[model samples]
Target: MEKKKINVAISGLNNVDSPGPGIPVIRALRESKLYDVTIIGLSYDSYEPGLYMEGMTDITYQIPFPSAGQEALLNRLSYIQQHYPIQVLIPNFDAELFNFIKLADRLKKEMGIHTFLPTVEQFEERHKANLPEWGRKYNIAVPRSQMIHSVYEIANLHHSYTYPLVIKGKYYEAGIAYNHDQAVGHFNKISAKWGLPIIVQEFLKGTEVNVTAIGDGKGNMIGAVPMRKQVITDKGKAWAGITLEDSTLLDFAAHLFKETHWKGPCELEMIRTAEGKLYIIELNPRFPAWVYLAVGAGQNHPEAIVSMALGETVTPFTTYESGKMFIRYSWDLICDLKSFEVISTRGELKL
Candidate 1:
């Protein structure tokens, strides 16, 4: 059978120590049974490893940073569309998702580009700063957290939060601080990179588990796979993980989707305590770097979302192979400097 051809554009290709979902998502799309994908890599930096990974992207275009504002991003996409004609766009970065979500309708109407993403309300409510209230509204357990915009707020945190708390930035980066000085240092460091409103969350003692799931716009869970991190990096990213047959985690994902009617991909970062109580630590609005594990396990969430974005009705995936594991490794790609030079100077490269 001839597979349907799909022209999909994806971003967040900085596959480094802390990787992004772009390459993994592209991998899933390449392996899809339903679609023959032409991967268009959207990159912010010339050094993004996915741009140079052989056979990974058919073409790569360097796009403006999210700080450049929505007009700049749309203009760039419009130009790219004139050349490559993107049918579906998947943005993988937290910082960039806001612009994508805001432009979803415009992208669909004006550019005929489809994107399956959470609504602005859904995105805003699940923010790290708003997790406490989101949890209360959904009746789910979440770690106590406080958002502070200034480093001076760290001194006052002791009255409300104890030692050994986790300090997180608004978009990315986090550090566990054990004392007042460490908390202040973390606040300063994260605030510098991601800006103010650092979140101080009560450190929960538990095993970290994550769920990579997808939801259709109308309150149906299209697919979900829960995994337990076997090995963690210094940056708290899962270096190795194994799929699990955890009903509780699956149920939690289903309930969240039903209540919020969340659209597109989401990763629920939760902790299972010694008493087996689960607490949502964070809610990433898009696919995680490790989402390829779900494809290996049986549910191809990235593919499913692409189909959904293109207006296809997909049946829910009820099961995945338990105990399937993903171990992340790095390999050096020997590429000619011409590839780098072209991308750096011309801002586009066709492999």
Candidate 2:
């Protein structure tokens, strides 16, 4: 009997000093024992390395960014479905998840591109600006954060919050501002790119830890892996990390899923202070760049995500080996101009 091959599409392949989850997600899928997989790389930029990586993506297509609106993205995917049917789409960007979540039903019914994503409400509640309230409801501790619409709001922050506060953009960028000037600087810069209501969070001096996990949307946690950043880039992204044996962290992630009934992939950014209190910082709606670490630790989260999207019953993954680690590095892949021109001109490249 011929094994059935499934087509899976993944996005967020911009792997530079700052990485994307697309390439790692594809790698996890290809490692699956349950299915023969054909990887379809969906990228926003032609220069994204995953599109040109030699053997990884069997086919590649450039789609409009979420800023282009759901209609444009749907049109692009609809066109792709005509040529090659896509069974599942695992979006890897937090900025892009809203559009995908909105179109999950349209894609599944009209185009048969099934996606496992959180509901719109679930996505909204997990935003950095809303994290405090969400945590209050879920019984998780979150740093005090206030949404500021103007840069002037930074000057008076000292009255309510102390110095060395954390400045955050709604969609991206987080920095510790030691003074009012730095706070305004981050507010201006991040707001210029991502737009705001900028968020100013109370700084908690703590060890940073993160959990990459997936949920069944019925309060069931399929897979969970906790890791602490051993090395960090200037951007505060993890460059090297190791899995930890932290039952508290695992329980924290499970509580989030149970309270929200979260569906699909997510990353829980946390802070553990001197007193051993864990504070929920940010909830990313999609997989993180370090997601491959979960695969190496024995969870295969991305593969399980695809299986769930296809309506297959996946037992919850209760245990994964500890002491696993990941070190991220960049390499230049040599690619000819022809492949670039093909995707640039036609918006897709097929092998």
TM-score of each: 0.98, 0.97
Q: Candidate 1: which pairs clash? A: none
TM-score of 1: 0.98
Stretches off by above 4 angstroms in model 1 are none
lDDT of model number 2: 0.90
Q: How many backbone clashes does candidate 2 have?
A: 0
Give the per-residue lDDT of model 2 (tens digit) for 248-335: 8898888888888999999999999999889889888999999999999999999899889999999988888899989988788888
Residue range 229-334, candidate 1, lDDT tens digits:
8999998899999999989899988888888898999999999999999999998999999999999999999999999999999999998999999999989888
Off by over 4 Å in 2: 1-3
